[model samples]
Target: MDHIKKVGVIGSGTMGAGITQLMVQNGCATVLFDIDKETVDKAKESIGSRLERLVEKKKISTEEMILAKELLQTTTDMNMFKDCQLVIEAAPEKIEIKRSIFQQLEKICAKDTVLTTNTSSLSITEISGQIENPRRVAGYHFFNPAPIMPLVEVVQGLQTAPETIEVLVQFAEGLNKKPVVCKDTPGFIVNRVARPFYNEALRIMNDQVASVEQVDRIMKSAGNFKMGPFELQDLIGIDVNFATTQSVHASFYGESRFRPHYYQERMVQSGSLGRKTKGGFYNYD
Candidate 1:
């Protein structure tokens, strides 16, 4: 862990920004990369504003915020990752895009530099299959709002080296997150085990068995869940949740247990993609 000082984060979007913030806050020099300068700049601004709010609440000192901002850098070049000891790719959930990033990273990164993905649905083994050193590729799945989410699934691909997993587990711990090791399986742990929550709720709603609010209330009251399925889907982005369900269902060869509901797809198509879009199951507006 001592040797893993400089880190690189690809994709300066929501998850990328959060992960970069986590790395910098924990005293690691982090480089945030994106396709263009504009997106990177916006992400930096958003992260800076968030850190300023933390300073206002005394969650972090002004000096600490300043240092974190300084420790974080934004880049439009993949070559900037040349010096990174660890690089986490948090790009969009597209396999081809991830494959291209890994291919480029292989050309720029050191042989021993650890590479991981923040993919919640994609297969880690498949993502690393074409890479020069598949041994270093693993999954470092973080939930939405990465800094606040405590659980990080450290998925070990079929070809991933044990030492790579050890370093990532330690790295996640360094970020003050709980790490769980799992094999490279579809949807990994949380997403795979949690399929029923959203899928069943959608089924119930579609079958006219219960309203979204009613189901949410029952789950919170009876199931003791902090938030109901619809609520969680909204928070996680309905589109993102839909993609996961679709991926898992396809991975299982159309297993009925993991089949996605049409209602969820309708929400995604309607652009009611949860809290991010101000609407999903329950309207945020």
Candidate 2:
């Protein structure tokens, strides 16, 4: 909203980096913040390489790539966000961490600055509950590999101003994303509806109805899914997917259908957290 030319992204992980890339590519000046300089430096290198790859693929011109890189900046200071028209928090999915960030953001950001969380499972209303001005806080959920994903969920908390939602929708579109406005329900839309795809697959495997390989093959071949549930889980990180399921289950008050299978929990406990850990439902080694 307000022709957001300067934006702040409060993380430097995969999602944050991708969001920053999207902002700069769209000609918005972006500041990426992290707790430490090492992380900020690494994200800068990763973003540079990604933009260069886009240029090599002819997806972007050399000049455009340079312009994007120039628009991007990094810092460890939260006070630097004073001028940001919008700040999207892509930090980890911890409530304390998020609440703390918002508390600080309330002091640093302008009153009109649209503060939003990219949390996939956390309740937007609850996340904004502690903010001084909850009206400006909302959810701006982006999927993994944000640069390639076109869909964005503009979630509205109970206290979120209607104009905030309107602003987020237009802001999403400015980055060439398809924005869908949704109530601040747990898991929102995709994560809630798509849970069965992963859970039932786990159930089937645990029940011996089929092996992991068989279930994956069937889902890909017969179901015509781009990636099998297991394959997708591996790519998404087993721990991450399991945490989302756990969060949904808790939000629903232990609904039977949303119950997490023991096998899934065991995978996280074993530290086989998918490709990031080099092992999960399948071994990458």
Candidate 3:
């Protein structure tokens, strides 16, 4: 944990920005970077507004809010990450983009510095293979709204050293997060075990066992899930959810249980991409 005083977050969209916010909230100095300057600025503004909400809700004192804002350094320059001890990449879900970033980070950061990715579906080994120090690179995946989410998946690649995992678990705990160490298997733990919930729910809907609304209601009441598959899909973005399912399915080599639902693909194609698009299985407006 002491090795993580300075953190660097690449990408400024939802996940990257959220990770940066969490690091700052944990009293770590964070440098946020994106290819686009405006995006980085937007990420900063979004975090600022979230901190203000915490202030209004009395979750954090005004002084803490000020300090939170001060801990983050949002920028478009990649070189600023040179001094960071740990850098977490949250770029698009493309292997090439990740490889490029890791190669560049290897050049910029110290040889002993730690590097991790927030990739949900990609194989950690495949990503780390792009860099020189695969031993120092591992997967540090976080659920959305990172600061609020307690669970973090610490992925051990095929070549990941045990000491690295120990340090990562300690690092996550330092930020007051629960860390679950798992093999670099597809979907790690939660996404792999939870696939049946979504796949079966989608099958029920497609089979006309019930409508999306009714299924969601039943799941919430009977299954005790805070949100049902369709509803959660909508909130997570139909495309994003579908893509994750597909990736896991492919990673499993077309396993029957992990099959990607046809309805989900159709929804994504129809642009019913959840709350961000204002429409999905349910309507936003």
Instruction: Choose the strongest candidate by TM-score.
Output: 1
Tens-digit lDDT string for candidate 1 (9-105): 9998789999999888889999999999999999999999999999999999999999999999999988999999999999988899999999999
Q: Any idea what lDDT model 2 has? A: 0.92
Candidates in order have lDDT scores of 0.93, 0.92, 0.89
Per-model TM-score versus the true fold: 0.97, 0.96, 0.96
Lowest summed lDDT across 10 adjacent residues in model 2 is found at: 1-10
**Over the stretch 165-203, how does candidate 3's per-residue lDDT look in tens digits?**
888899999999999998899989988887888889989
Candidate 2, residues 87-173, lDDT tens digits: the string is 999998888999999999999988889999999999999998987799999999998789889999999999999999999999898
RMSD of 1: 1.1
Identify the runs in model 3 with alpha carbons over 4 angstroms from their true place. none
